[model samples]
Target: MTALHCDGSLTADRASYGGIIRDDNSVLGMELLAILRGVTLCIQKDLLRVSIRSYSKLAVDILNGIVSCPWSLQALKVRITSLMEQLQRKEIRHVWRELNQPADFVAAIDTGDGESFFYPPDFPLDLVELIKNDSDRKTYFRTPSH
Candidate 1:
């Protein structure tokens, strides 16, 4: 099962969820990502104790197609309305793919395998470590001068 985390959460208790839904349509990557965001947000809502206030952010690293494709664009808009209506405020932003390697890897596996694959939360320790190491390297290099 895939683990979903809430990026806007401050508590350690906020990140507990797992599930995989097969996508038979082989939807475009951006569209799939959009759907994942919506589903994850819905799950997040269930896990949280209180309502999420305005300005909560959901960052994603995806193609411009999310906004460029009419169908995908509309589908994504609908996801928020239908799935996230309970939340008072939220923001979704597209980040650089390099900053979101783990998520990219997960999506790639979903598409490349052509079949859904679920694993324990710690199943891919190596991959998770690689992402953590890359993030640390970037942080080190980007550290501000004294």
Candidate 2:
């Protein structure tokens, strides 16, 4: 199974959303966008079984139909639903932000360019370290940002 972690960050100056910069200020919108992009990438890579993790409980609930999707996000909801149907198996779960640091870091990065995917050798060193720590089940603390 392929595991995908996703996140979105909104700051006073700008928003780094779903691997792209957008004028939208809604953090929820950004979270949904990140999930959409992650799922889309999974499909493109022919990953049929996937586990998607997000720190937004609302986003997870909305995607799982546990909560109603807002009217503004109906289109995105529909698209995500359609894409999910193509998967052989899937699990969408809400996790603590600490457990999702790699994705959070990626979402916070503003490259000014659109989506980016990094493979081994080309992966950012910081990200690689984070992934290694996660895989090793090492514990770390993150100070909450205002």
Taking the candidates one at a time, how many backbone clashes does each contain? 2, 0
Candidate 1 local lDDT, residue 29: 38
| lDDT against true structure, model 2 | 0.85
Alpha-carbon TM-score of each model against the true structure: 0.44, 0.76
RMSD of each: 16.0, 9.4
Instruction: Identify the leading candidate in terms of lDDT.
Output: 2
Quote the positional error of residue 23 for candidate 1 in Å: 18
- TM-score for candidate 1, please give it: 0.44
Off by over 4 Å in 1: 1-29, 32-73, 110-121, 134-146
Question: Model 1, range 52-86, lDDT digits (tens) per residue?
Answer: 22111222322222333335355654554455445
